[model samples]
Target chain A: MGDLNTVVQSIINLPPAVILALGALLIPALPKRLRSPWFILLPVLALTFLWFLPVIQLSDYCIVAWNYADYSIMPYVSDNLSRLFSTAFLVVLITGGLFSWHNTDSGEKIATLFYASGAVGVVLAGDYLTLFIFWEVMAIASTWLIWGCGDVESGDVGMRYLLYHVLGGGLLLAGILVEVMNTGSIQLQSFAGLSGSDLLSNPGVLLILLGVAVNAAFPPFHTWLSDAYPKASITGAVFMSALTTKSAIYVLIRLFPGMDILVWIGLIMAIYGTIFALMSNDFRQILSYSILAQLGYMVTAIGVGSEMALNGATAHAFSHILYKSLLFMTGGALLYSVGTNRLSDLGATLKEATDQDPKFASQSRWLFGFYMIGALSISGLPLLNGFISKPMIIEAIGEAHYEIAMLILIAASIGTFLHTGLKIPYYTWFTRDSRSGSKPLKQSLNSKASFGEIPVNMNLGMGIGATLCLVFGIAPVIVYDLLPYNVIYEPFRAYPIAESLLTLSGAFFIFIWMKSRLLTPGVLRDLDTPLRATLPWIRQVFVDFPWAIFEKAEEIVLAFTRMVIKTVRNPLAWLQPYSSEEESTSTHSTEAFTPAIEIVIGLILFTSLVLGLFLIF
Target chain B: MINASNSERMNQSSFFTRLPLWIAILAAAVGLTLEFTLLRGYASHWWNHVPAFYLLYGALAAIALLGLSIWGSKVLNRQEAAGTNEKEA
Candidate 1:
């Protein structure tokens, strides 16, 4: 009885990431029937363990550590922040698992489990070393999802994705090493007190910031997201949409909250994501860009560094994960059902799907409803989750008296509505080619279409996410209670409602006015343009150039080897300087071993043999 | 109209064609009214003192963003290679 109690206690103390990771190892052995259920159950069990663990507290840290050599490695650290973020992650995992319930690919399933585990592990980690380990695990496992799509383009995109993450992981490791040496400790701590130029003095923190920035999709480094997400396996995109950047945001919230530079950086990201999203034509690509824009809000809140602001960032991240995953799931369903992501062609693609499966006719309407919930939630429409969380950051900025920053964030919100609320829904489900008198463009019909019925599980997954968005939106206290800091804030007030409605209305009107101008089907370039353009040159300098020089050197060495061999064969090939024409005409002349050459060779060999024999004697 | 399908012709005359514009106008009107009346007492920020500030600011900001994006499209949009676009996938 005591042993049983001890075992139960031990299991409760185990980190949620370890549970999922250990369960992931058993995936392949499970029968196909059991895999999906197991996947869903794992996160549920992890969440149960997370909540039931005795040490989890709101204000103080309760660490679960393993002593190794001279190090006290704390792998399970329970604070409100890690707990809240991990809860969000686990919830998304369950929903994502359900969404991909029909997927037969065990490789993708395993990768997803490991990927999710890594993300949860990062937040739970008490030390930098543990954080870096989980960070690389995330990088590698997520790359596997990209590759599992099994297309030439996805393969290429996955390689690029891996390269970026590996680079990020390297930078993080460098920072961690420097920090350990300088501080004589690997424990993670807040750099929030280091502001402005004081941050310049902490090279380790700066390196770590740069590393986390890469994963967070902070501009220039952000292209990997847009470039890869739209091309990921339909189900993979759903998980990818929720995990990577949000985990990085969690890290920022943990490590660098209140760093002043992040405010401007966040503002830039917000505008940058909005602009790029507006110009994009791919549905999933648009969502990916919006993730960047939304992440900007959280980053800004973290920069504000107030209790309400950090709480706001955490709440927004939690809500963003759900809604964004829902959007991606619906978008994935659209992509899965119609086999395309082009915004201008979505209506026609759905039209095409009706012929393949009659049920596909109504799927679009259902998907649109689900998609809008996500869209409106992200736009911070009143009564949705976005309204509950987004305004907190804006209000915090307002309270801090950075009036311009407040206004810019407000404008960014307007832009968010402009694209997500108006442009995406408008072009995807309702657009008509004016030239053709309300018909979808004829060219879109000419494209290949693989129309089918959306799986029931996909809808169920989306329904769960949509329901959570509403529940959280209507009851902000549920999210508020989980916040690390104690703060009183209200979301459903008259002023916020008016602000949201006015902004959305304004965006909606402009969208109608600029409808034609917004039909952007062309591929959009971003800061990644120079990188994409110079990729071949980079390959040439790094790969092809070195190989070419090596090849030339190899050829010269081979030619010298051949000359020595020829000399040994006849003893006259080098001694005789034949004209080029003579050498060309008489290919076999040297092979006949002339008597004079053979005699000289024999005499040299005899002399060498005699000298060797004398020396041995 | 000679080569058009029956559904295409119906789409041209459908209520859906005009519904969005009406909705946008209605929403704008309601938003302005709410900002001016019901929510006026809730104004704590300086910008809130301006008449229909959120409505006007939202509109102007959207227009500026649209202008900037249109310019951006010209500089940034590339012709995607055939069979390489996400639509085909």
Candidate 2:
């Protein structure tokens, strides 16, 4: 009985990656209708199992044996941080999966399962090697999701996406190799300082940092995200929004806490993402950009590296996954019903429905209401999820004495208000006058369009997420209890409440002012233009330039060959006797050539001269 | 019409774009100066500490330039729009 209990416990303690691998095999066998919902259930089951298992110490797992170096072995959950991140990841996977249930494609399910497994492995990894293995797995899986869009444009975007991630993975792998060589150990425990004295400061750390930055979608390397995300299938976009970057943030907090470079980089990303989001016209593109901005808050918080800051980072990550998924769900619903995600192609579907045509308006109202709640939550409006989570991050920044970081964060908050908070909902759901009535007319013209809402499964999935957003906003103690670190900072204090209200009111005033002035409808472009427009042109130039050179070279060779042939055919030439009918006939019959014999004679003379020089020397 | 040739078709200028090229040039100059002259002193204090300061300064300069560019582009856009309206009339 005792041994049986031990066996059961061991199976329960099997890392989420193993279960995810099993789920990947199980997914294809599932009926088409069951695939997505099964994915949602699989993560939930994993989380429940983790919750019930006994926690062990890091020493319990031997990641490297002298004989078994080549086989990748993962560490089970041993630390509070790993448990916290893993639990949150499981929740994200389930929620994201549920939200995407209406999307029936096999690729999204397979890719999402692999992506979730990678995130799980990262959180639970005992060593750098295991972490890197999952990291590359995530890169390949997410790229596949992007490629599953199945269009020429998406294929091109996916290639660019692959290029960036593969490069990142390479850098990370190199870093791991160097670290292993220096330390003779592969454990991923905390390390101090940046001088290459220890394994942490070696080339390995830099390479790993570069790799993490790519996944985080940090600048110059961020073009791949904005270029590909908006073009993803609606459900794929929602899942993509939640996982890859957050996993990078998780690893950053785990590996390099208090690295001051992260603080500055996070601040830049915050402001940069928000500014570009404000300029974008595509709805999903705006959301993609906002993901970068929100991640900045977490990355910056992690940079502070204090207990309060780390907690804030973790808490913000939890809330971000929920609200961001909600927003993407709203966008996905819009795409499904309207067949477009462009802001210019959107209108007030709710207002268009009259008493005789009430179903469409009701559905639109549900979607728009869901969208409003998500926007308000993400905007850090008082009493929503963002208000609760964002203030903790801001307090952490204040505690760290990073005044510039605070200012940048505030600017980013306001910019979030401008783009996601005000712009997205206003353009897609509220503004009836900006774009003509093309959308409504199209809907009315198609009799097959039933004016129905999204499938019950999808709506229920969204409802689950939306309810959690409201619950978390109203009472954040539920999340605080689950945090890896002991909570020292109180989020319900007067200062935080007052500050949040002030920001919300300030954003509201700005919106009113902009709306009154009719300044809100114009399109704003972002950093992706150079990538989307200029790079293709640049490639064309390079491609054509090389081709032009090749063509000229080919022409020269052809001209030379023709000249040789003309000279050989000339009756007055030195070879005229050899070119006589009988001699030519014999040569043609035997496949022999006078030109070949002459070339051999020239080669012999050249070699003899080279040999003579060698002998003399 | 999504005109490819119109200069106006270029993406909206942000802070990185609107900075006077000289400001960027000057910022780069300051960065290079710090890297060559002052970094050694800071590095001696603590190797990690010096890189931290450099990273912060670099970030601050980039943010300042970005903010300036965003504001400058908004101003330029307004002027261009006004000029185009006048020509139309």
Candidate 3:
């Protein structure tokens, strides 16, 4: 029928993000048994819509377009860049949904769906307002993923995480407003001119870049990622791992590609992450820091601003989402089964678990096997996903002739393998040495921690991620074809393979030599140390002081009202002096009116008389 | 050096333990050979022409990162547990 066709056409015109968001709202209403299935089905449906949609233009394919004032806002864009990023977000949603299948809390599940919708929306948005709205949605929804852990620390960590994001969202809004006022347009494509020093010279672009940098986990602004993700609920960490930073990278690729300042910022950020990851004792904390390191490579490629580099950044983001989520899933599985995330605690528990039942050790080995696949993939080992993408960025930098930047990135590659691939596994599963002298197993054994079997769903999620890593790595064309640019580079060639093997081998050898020294325990203070230390004082001065002043002013008004009531109700009481005892007990009471109150009343009466005379005249 | 796990100690001579070392050695040899022979023409960049450059570069870079990290860890190491010092006070 004609009416049915209209309905179908309308649904088809809806953005994929909006469909997922509407599905997210319906989650709690669904039966408990259907929640996980519904969660997985939505992204799959969105992915289908994403690919099957008709393309009007390959570069800026817009759908669901609407006008705001004089500006035409495209809420859904299906360019190659957006498509590549959206595909990753949607795929991770399915895998993350599967990982959290056993989670009883519908709030966290709903938050993740909404969070993915925000990320997808941001990537697909063709204008700044749409981008900013989804950017904040991602921030707010992701914060729930942290707080939904329902732990004592989760609340505090989530609050800090929210504050950081609110600040970022504010900066982004300010930039968008300034840019619209200056240029009279909100099109994101207009930022292509924002390259080199011109980016810094423009206040709007700089503010926008600063906002995106906060989400990208760029150095001093990056502590939130390390601070929050480890503290998020077990399954929530998996979703948080995939969405937040990569979406920022998507924004950067779309808006600020080729900004020269990013080159240095990204390089420092890469080393900063590696250094902190090396110092960390918590398993998930190390992974969080390594996310920063991995993001650095993509950021550096974006700074290069060539077709190959942008493609490399895009490809790396797609691959990073898969492998990193797998790593987090394994980390989450460890926390779920073992009731601890500390590396020192994990080694002892696994050791004790092995002593209790040998089979437990083998099962733990299977978890480790899944973990190593991700590790090797991230380390850019030959025949893995990292090899296919990371080399493109480094090769692009080499082509750009920024030899120093290239060398530092390669060194960072060595550090990545050292900390993540070698040190995390060695210290977590194999080491007998207790870097921290505390007997963590005592607490874990008595609590919910167990040597029992890991849930089947966890393995299924990890298996899906592992399969994708292999599929994409073996067939580089799959990822290459998804890229925004033509593929001219070869990852399988002799030079890159040799380079990856040599660097990874050298990293492996050094890790063997220095694994003991690297098995550090206890808190590794970062730049956030000073911030956390001063946050209380900062809050008191910035937040509490003004509030105190407002309260004092409110008290004065209440006192004056009481005096006026007494004057009107009993004229004799207004003339009578207060006793000293009454005055001391209640300073703001009607009985305690002083000369200042009388002078104010006299001035008011005089003003009323003058106003009355003027009106009569 | 990483101490062997109890299971690995029981089979100290297992090929898996030594297999990584062998692979590293062989990879270095093969990488060096490829740089000199079949991949010689692939050296479009100046750094690629340096003999066994990536192998040396990777080794030195690893050492430098480890050395710096050791010193950095010593400086930044906190005896207090995480989140304890920053409790909601």
Candidate 4:
């Protein structure tokens, strides 16, 4: 009975799941002015509950000797790590929800609720079974959000997106099943001691690693993310930018922290993402690719598997969810105002705005500036959130003595600066007269003036995300504390900070040099070219080819059938049978009748032979 | 353009119409032969091992049939082109 009370206490201590489930229902019932505030308040409440929850490990069910009577629900509040992830997740949800206060659509509201639910479920799940259930819920909910993009193209992308996630989910479930079957336990915890020999001895570990790898966007399986993310609605993309990959990273850190394959795989993904991003033309697509690249940094850190590296990965994940979301939100705002997202069609409308039009130019510039800050943070610019997290990873790579991995990580960082930090801002905000032919600059600017600044609630969302980016950047200690692992290494040591600063300054100089050379922005094709251009061409070739062949075959078959019918139906054809009947009748009849008689005699003889053999046996 | 001579028009359309199928068939055959020879051996790594050969064979057959159809179309087009050229002359 005392143990039951302990379980009840843990359950009660955890935030009510009903809060998120009922948030959408209650938000609309409130006055329009109060809606956004309430949305903001709900996540804060959840965060508060998360913070207050007592740390204790409890089992929900205990069975003795396979007896049904002893089964009981045991509640547990296990450790600080669960609290750390749950707290950060709730904080992101609160900030993101507040940021999206101006979104009036019920689709966003419901989807956001489910999305939050999925994240919370991941953070709180005690067992592999519980974790998987939430993992799939997250996939389904995010897909629904992508489907809310309200376009035919988005619909197509959404279906592909769902297929990939389902595949990942299936892999994850298979891994879980294997682990449960092998271990007779479903607990989700560190498998640090598992060795190569042990892994070979038990195949379940490999299955679990494969499952985690898919969601981590390990190469080849990563296409779905880049495919669907850019196609989502702006708000939906923001939510997506934060959750799925980060959850996978969290799971990897939790499960297979020391696996050496992760190191190489992470390096490959980072470079691959960066190179493709360099080639991308779309605004959100670049961000999507950047997400993969950024996840690579964390994954590599996890691969390093030292205390400092794990902490770095954890802290980086926290900061990334904030800054990346801000960048996406900024891009979304631009898309919302201007009719197009293509860089070649966008120009410095902010600079062109009349001083009299305070709102348009001022707000635009501010958003653009905030976006640059977010970019810098992601680029590992000094005195920002990225500065704190990225160096930790670099240090870990160095500590692990992986020279090639370190080199790749550094090169990828430079590439990130080249594409995202420099190219994105220069092309979208500062470039000269790209849209000259489409519309008169003044007229287009005037049309944009009418749309004015983004709605206040949207601005608030972006503002909150941007502020967190700066806060995390400026104060590394706060983020460092939030990490699940104990951090003995400091982010603010003068030598490391100076080194990172030098690297970033070098990257900035390179960006400026490239811009001077007019090499910052240009159309470069990527892997997507196959699907976008070549695959369709291939499909067209196949489709047309098969149709033509079938059509020709149909024609030939029709002709042959016609000829056969003509011969059969014509009385003259049958009547004119067998060469000159008068001349050959005697010989032809004798030949045909003789063969028929021989066949009949042969069958009778063979039957008799078979019967005689059977009788003898 | 439509009044071009038969041989000239056939030369032009043959490259566009027949080349893709020819390439596809050649690729399919190579793929099939590679799978049949290599995939059954222990020396082949799992990642590099070829998939079932039947898929390649089927692809080759489909492409061959397609090539034949294209060849037929080219012949028909040449005849039409000749007739048009004669009318023009």
Tell me each candidate's TM-score. 0.89, 0.74, 0.89, 0.69
| Regions more than 4 Å wrong, model 4 | A1-11, A15-18, A22-35, A55-78, A193-202, A348-358, A436-449, A516-617, B1-89
Model 3, which residues run further than 4 Å from truth? A1-4, A53-60, A553-617, B1-13, B82-89
RMSD each, Å: 5.2, 13.7, 6.2, 20.2
lDDT of 3 by residue, A284-320 (tens): 9999999999999999999888899999999999999
DockQ, per model, reads 0.41, 0.02, 0.34, 0.01
lDDT of 2 at A567: 74
What TM-score number comes out for model 4?
A: 0.69
Q: How many pairs collide in each candidate, listed in order?
A: 0, 5, 0, 8
For model 3, the TM-score of its B chain against the native B chain is 0.70
Docking class of 2: incorrect
Per-residue accuracy of model 1 over A243-279 as CA lDDT, tens digit each: 8999999999999888888888899899999988888
- Residue-wise lDDT of candidate 4 within A216-301, one digit each (tens)? 88887788778877778777788888888888888888887877777888888887787667656567878888988998898888
lDDT of 2 at A365: 62
Among these predictions, the greatest DockQ belongs to 1
Candidate 2: count the clashes. 5
- For the predicted complex of model 4, DockQ is 0.01
Worst 10 residues of 4 chain A by lDDT: A59-68
Q: After superposition, how far is residue A445 of candidate 1 from its true place, in Å?
A: 9.4
